[model samples]
Target: MLHYLLTLAIFFAFFAVEAWGLNLQFGLTGILDFTYITFVAIGAYFAGVAAMTPSTNGGMGGSYIFGWQLPFPLSPVIGGIAAAMLGVVVGIIGLRRLRSDYLAIVTVSVGQIVWMVIGNATPLFNGWDGIVGVPQPYNSVMNLSTNNYEWPFLGISVIVAAIIFWLVRSLTESPYGRILRAIREDENVAAALGKNVFRYRMSAFVIGAFIAGISGALQIEYIGAWNPSGWTTLETFIVWAAMLVGGRGNNRGMLLGAFLVPVLFTEATRWITIPAHPLLMEAIRGMAIGLLMVLAVRFRPQGVIPERKRVFPLTTIPGLKEDVANGHTAQG
Candidate 1:
């Protein structure tokens, strides 16, 4: 049971990073970005292809482009850049002015196409068989076996998560993050205010994709496999649910969302009165997530941990902004 709980913790923690990335893109930027998981898939595929051995397992493909077999840390970085580059390429075409719903349709369609291409093209991505027995980080040079000393690799993941969380927190607090929020609120107003809305949007979108790649890299390394079957578009909805439940636009809320939704759900399953059935359990999980999203958006749109508002001092406020900025503040 302890091991099971530990596994749950690690799994949710990996997705917490995904939630953070998606929050930055969708929650903070007001962009749908339903292709979020595609970037994760890219990272997973890139990392898997690059790190995997040229071996065959269960007839899965491991014939990746980078035959050099780089270090684990370096390989994920490459995957992340690849995701970002792909994001840029897609965004240039997809982000052209279109209605919100139209944009979602286009991007989501692109996602499906990308998945199909990877599934059908064996030379490019080894087709549907996917990659297996991918190498883990630092396993070779560290002289540690995957069979033993799992703690060391686990510890490495925890450290990487910490670093990523800290970086995201810092970025959200920086001016760049504020610009993103500005664009989200009113792109027209932000542009009128001299903010390059499109550029800023592209920046957030690409960076979010990069971070997603990191999450994918970590997950593939931990599991030692990557398959097209695992990273469906529904995966993006899961991250969205986490972001909304935890509190959109709040970094800590993303982590809390990750834990409360998946980690706690696994724990709560112990009280299940019905016998376990795979299809039924999956349905229940989906319904639960959908209900959670509805409840969160309808009842508590701000989330469990609301974004902290910055209070500006009086005196220098704009047009009655003094009172508004000060303690007795109302509207301008």
Candidate 2:
């Protein structure tokens, strides 16, 4: 029971990271990135291959290209970089002039394309079988039982999640974040105010991809394997649901939604000892999640924790107070 709870805790942390990234893109920047999980898959595959030694013909596991035998921190970092690179490519292609809904379609297309390619390309990530036996971080030196090792790994996961949360929060509260919000609300107005709409949107997209990549790396490390089956368009929808339920444009809301949707609504379903077909059970779970999303949208469109408006005092503008005191008002 304790181990099960620990597992849920780890999932909460991972979902928090992924949901935060989605919030930055969909919630703040107004980018409908339906291909977000592709980046996660890229990260997971890269991390898995990086940690494993090169596969040979006689090897028991599947074959993969890179087996860098890298340590923990470096593997996840590389995974993040790879995901960001993919983001740059996609953002350049779709974010140039595509509207939100249109961009979403493009993302879905791109996601399917990537998924198909990865699923067929055997040499890349072992095709449908996927890569397995990914080594955990610090397991060699720790030399603890699998159960005991999870404790330290859980600590590492929490630390990484916390760091991501802090970094994302700081970015969202910064001027850059405000500009993204401005672009989200009205791009034409933001452009008229001399903001480079494309640049800001691209930055947000890439940054979000990086965070998703990190989350994927952590997930692969925990599960010790990854395949195309694990990352589908459905995963993207789950992240979107989290942002919607928690409140878009609010980091705290992302965290809360992450816990509620993924950990509570999704994971809680597993405890029910149902006597049904696996496929039927999976369908039931999906229906439950869908129902929750519909109810949330119907009742609380703004989410459980609505995003707070950023208000600045007029006095904050330089020389505005002095001009007012001198009874001098400039005309446009």
Error of 2 at 95 (Å): 0.5
* Candidate 2 lDDT tens digits, 224-251: 9998888876677778788899999999
The number of residue pairs in model 1 that clash at the backbone is 0
Model 2: lowest-lDDT 10 consecutive positions: 323-332
Clashing pairs in 2: none
Please report, as a residue range, the 10-residue window in candidate 1 with the lowest summed lDDT.
55-64
Candidate 1 TM-score to native: 0.87
TM-score to native of every candidate shown: 0.87, 0.92
Clashing pairs in 1: none
lDDT of 1 at 99: 34
